[model samples]
Target chain A: DQQVKQNSPSLSVQEGRISILNCDYTNSMFDYFLWYKKYPAEGPTFLISISSIKDKNEDGRFTVFLNKSAKHLSLHIVPSQPGDSAVYFCAASNRANAGKSTFGDGTTLTVKP
Target chain B: DVKVTQSSRYLVKRTGEKVFLECVQDMDHENMFWYRQDPGLGLRLIYFSYDVKMKEKGDIPEGYSVSREKKERFSLILESASTNQTSMYLCASSSLGRVWGETQYFGPGTRLLVL
Candidate 1:
């Protein structure tokens, strides 16, 4: 079973606009959510993260909003740049569980110039 | 900066051959993990070790084994590689945490091709 899911396989947005990537989870036990950005042939780098207690977390141009009630979360990049184009993965983990994270299928975001 | 290095960026092996993938972390992390990424399937954990000599099976550990003889290195072993095992393998390491979940740093990944 896929505990975490990224319904959208890919997304496209024009440069200088906003890009939003969505993710959902079935497991309520997950209290921590993290987002990672990956480029071709490179490992994923940490972007932003939010705890279950918080509704949103921001890091520079990247912002992650979490809605526990809806069991959903979204990553927003304002003024998206062409360099932002890459695969984004959403992951969640329950503190009680030895920090084993469940990952979504990932969404490929393309920021057009 | 914390760096996770995988032994190889690409590898090719014949079916039924024994294969080994090595990972080394310079961050002095106590936790190390191995995962395989396949198209459409996402990243599935193969194995993890929280401490030297201690290992745990993750979501998918079949046909795989892990060894952590040193704190900074973790090795994944494939007894007999199969074609289905061809995929990108990633290694990650994180520090042990209490209430907060630490972020895992990953290597560039090793693409394994078993023909």
Candidate 2:
């Protein structure tokens, strides 16, 4: 069973537009949610995260919103640049689980110039 | 910044050959993990260690074993490599006793192919 799911395998957006990637989770025990960005031939890097206590967290160009009732989370990048193109993964972990993260299938985002 | 390094960026091995993939982390992290990434399956954890000389099996650990003799190093061993094991292997480290959510730092990844 896939606890975390990224239904969309890929997404395309125009430069300077908003790019939104969605993710859903089936486990309600997950308390912490995170997003990681990965490029070709490279490892994934931490992008943004949101705790279950808060509904939203924003960092510069990246923002993550969490809806606990719906068990869904979304990552939004405003004014998307070509360099923002990469595979994005959504992961969740509960404090009781000792931070062992369960990651999604990942969504490949392409920002067109 | 946490830096995780893998021994090789690419490797090739034959079936039934023993393979070892080494990983080292600069940060004094207490937790280390090994994961395999496939084309459509995403990243699946093979094994993880919470402390030196201590380890646990992840979701998929059938063909893999792990060793952690030192705090900064973790190794994944394939007793007999097979063609189906060909994929990208990723190593990650995370410090324990942090906040509610701890972020893991990953290595560049080692692409392994078995003939």
Candidate 3:
């Protein structure tokens, strides 16, 4: 069973615009959510994360919003740039299970320059 | 900066062959993981080790085994390779001290092809 799911396989947005990537999860036990950005032929790098307590967390150009009621979270990039184009993966895990994470099928973001 | 290095970028092996994939980390992390990435299927964990001489099976550990004789190195062993095992393999390491669910750092993946 897929605990984490990303419905959209790909997304396209214009540069200097906002890019939103959505993800959903079936497991309510997951209290922490993280996003990773991956480039072609390269490993995924950590982007941003949010805890269940907070509804939103922001880091520079990236912002992540979490809704516990909906069991959904989204990663938003403001003024998206060409460098923002990459595959974004949403992962969920709880404190008890520290290193084991359930990752969603990544969403490929394309920022048109 | 933490660095995770895989043994190879690409490899081709014949069926029924024993395949070994090595991974090393320079950060002295206590947690190491091995995952396989297929097209459409995201990263699926095959095995993980929290410390030297300790290991745990992940979501998909069938037809595969792992070893961690040393803290800095982890190895994935395929007893008998099959065509279905052809995929991109990734290695990741994370520190136990982090707060947000152990932020994992990954290395460049190794693409293995079983013919």
Candidate 4:
């Protein structure tokens, strides 16, 4: 059973437009959510995170929003650049349990010029 | 900066052969993890170690074993390699945290192919 799911396998957006990636989770115990960006042949880099206590968290050009009632979260990147093209993964964790994190299947985002 | 290194970036092995994948971390972290990445499956945990000589199975641990003799190093062993085991392996290390969540630092990854 996949605890976390990214319904869309791929997403495409024009440069300078907003790119939105969505994720859902079935585990209610998860309290912390994070987003990671990965390039080809490179390790994933931490992007932004949101705690269950808050509905939203923002970093520079990236923003993450969480809806606990819906068991869903989304990552939004405004003014998307070509460099933003990569696979994005949504991860969730319940720190109380050994800090193990569950990750989604990842969404490949392509920012077109 | 935290650095996690894998023994090999790519490896090819024949089916039924024993394979060992080694990972080392320089950050003195207490938590270490092993994950396998597939094309559309994302990252799935195989094993994780909380301390020296301690380990716990993750989401997918079948046909895989792990050893953590030292706090800085973790090893994943495939007793008998199979074609289904071909995937990108990743190692990560992180420090335990109380409130401010722990951040996992990952290695580049090792691509393994079993023919």
- Index of the highest-lDDT prediction: 2
- Tens digits of per-residue lDDT, candidate 4, B1-115, equal 9999999999999999999999999989999999999999999999999999999999899999999999999999999999999999999888896574667889999999999
Docking quality level of the chain pair in candidate 3 = medium
| Model 4 deviation from native, Cα RMSD in Å | 0.9
Q: How much lDDT does candidate 4 score?
A: 0.94
Candidate 1 lDDT (Cα, whole model)?
0.93
**After TM-score superposition, what is the CA distance of residue B2 in candidate 1 from its true location, in Å?**
0.7
Colliding residue pairs in candidate 1 = none
Q: Write down the DockQ of candidate 3.
A: 0.77
Winner of 1 and 4 under DockQ: 1
Judged by TM-score, which candidate is best? 2
What lDDT tens digits, residue by residue, belong to model 4 across residues A1-113?
89999999999999999999999999999999999899988888889998999999999999999999999999999989999999999999888868778999999999999
Tell how far residue B34 is off in model 3, in angstroms.
Answer: 0.4
lDDT of 2 by residue, B39-113 (tens): 877789999999999999999999999999999999999999999999999999998887787899999999999
TM-score of chain B of 2: 0.98
User: For model 3, which pairs clash?
Assistant: none
Candidate 2's displacement at residue B94, Å, is 0.2
Stretches of model 3 off by over 4 angstroms after superposition: none
Off by over 4 Å in 1: none
Candidate 2 or 3, higher lDDT? 2
DockQ, Cα level, model 2 = 0.82
